[model samples]
Target: MRLPKDPTPIRTIEVVPYDPAWPAQFEAIAAPIRAKLSPLALGVEHVGSTSVPGLTAKPIIDLDVVISSRLQLPEVVSKLTELGYVHEGNLGIPGREAFMWPDGNGRHHLYVCSVNTPNLHYHLLFRDYLRQHPDKALEYGQLKEKLAKQYPGDMDGYSEGKQDLISRLMQEAEALSGFALHQP
Candidate 1:
């Protein structure tokens, strides 16, 4: 698979104070996605680290839009491209598709998937879990900062570092929110 142009190789992760701008930024991006995909989309949600307030992130927003089928991918890609997104295959993660918005600021990571796709929902559930629970969010933030430091320049390594923590947190979220969790 071709690597994404802007690889976020780790450097010290810092859970900076919550930026109130995140929600508005998400809405701005979501509006276009919703409009373009409405006929094909089941729902659109803000996922990933940026979606959680008081959480430090890689400064890139992550959005997920649930569509009906894998066959619908081409259309989704075309539509998103028309709106300035550059398609990027999941590279390694299957059952999920990714895209990068060509914003000079390097703003977002967008994904499209099926409604029945558990991984998509799991990401949303995790985001919601962190949002609703401040302590956990803080803990995750610290973990990220540490992982960033340890895995600097290693994007794959950085992601692997968080796998265990994410798994355990997903369990807590499932129990507390009753959202079904998908093991990736």
Candidate 2:
């Protein structure tokens, strides 16, 4: 649980067409992690673009392994480490801890977040919104495509560029889901 001396480099952003196999890929990755964490993991779910069917994405699965409290985070981090993931503390987002698998396992982003955190809720709400609205998902896919092209080598820029769109979508999603948007 020690931080690396150097930061991980931002790689070029590459968005690919929707792959039907993405869900299965998530299951393959989640199963073992879930088994290892057991009750400490309130739930483990696939979130982000890969979770929605027919949405073009970067092809990296985004997962959230939820816990009941922040107190459990260290244990979760230890468990994930045993599974070969390096804990990469929140990466600027509070209420969630990021983890990266050693090179070559697969392309994925994993996070551990407490139940009911705004960040976690946002992820679920946004994912479900896209799932229920194909047209909106298509719009989102298009946005990602444009952003990826504009910020080809800048991951931060790509993500930053999507903030406005994501915020608007999240507001709509929060209304639909009856969860007040929590801003950090």
Candidate 3:
């Protein structure tokens, strides 16, 4: 039996070796958002594989715009819009909100989550754990490389594939950090 080639254009997924400049890039992206949202935004945190030193990633920076409470969500959304980010309304994640990046700056993912959001804790814990354990980070990097090749062009497929490992690592991260996931 012959399988037909799918007509959908495969979006290129490029997983590259960890770049030392990722931290600086994060800082650059965070600075303005930090400045614009001052007092409202608790902090713009760098997470994801890019934030983990020496971890292979898709090169797209991931950030969390933390707020003190959900009461601040409206204001945060308004200000981020002024900063050139269009709010994407949590994208099915309850506590966190996603955004489209501004034109003319490098590509990145921006998320907003209040202090008690589990998503926020997940990202921080996973990134911090990977930073502390280089061996595990390397293992994660290898996994990402393999998955990128296996699921190239299917972004959803790529993300779904990493869930099992992500879940395991999240558990390890939570245990090590002693931080329990909580809802807002």
Best by lDDT: 2
Task: List the pairs of residues colliding in candidate 2.
Answer: none
- Better candidate number, 2 or 3, judged by lDDT: 2
| lDDT measured at residue 152 in model 3 versus the true structure, 0 to 100 | 84
Shift in Å, residue 154, candidate 3: 1.6
For each candidate, the alpha-carbon lDDT, in order, equals 0.82, 0.90, 0.88
Q: What clash count goes with each model?
A: 0, 0, 0
For every candidate in turn, the CA RMSD to the true structure comes to: 4.5, 4.5, 4.5
Candidate 3, residues 1-184, lDDT tens digits: the string is 9999988766788999999999999999999999999999888899988999899999899999999999988998999899888887879888899998766245799999998888898888888899999998998889889989998888888889888888788777777777866322
Which 10 residues in a row give candidate 2 its minimum summed lDDT? Answer: 3-12
Please write out the lDDT profile of model 2 over residues 1-184, one tens digit for every residue. Answer: 9888766666789999999999999999999999999989998989999999999899899999999999988888888999999988999998889998988456899999999788898888899999999998999999999999999989889999989988888888888877777654
In TM-score terms, candidate 2 sits at: 0.90
Write the number of the candidate with greater TM-score, choosing between 1 and 3. 3
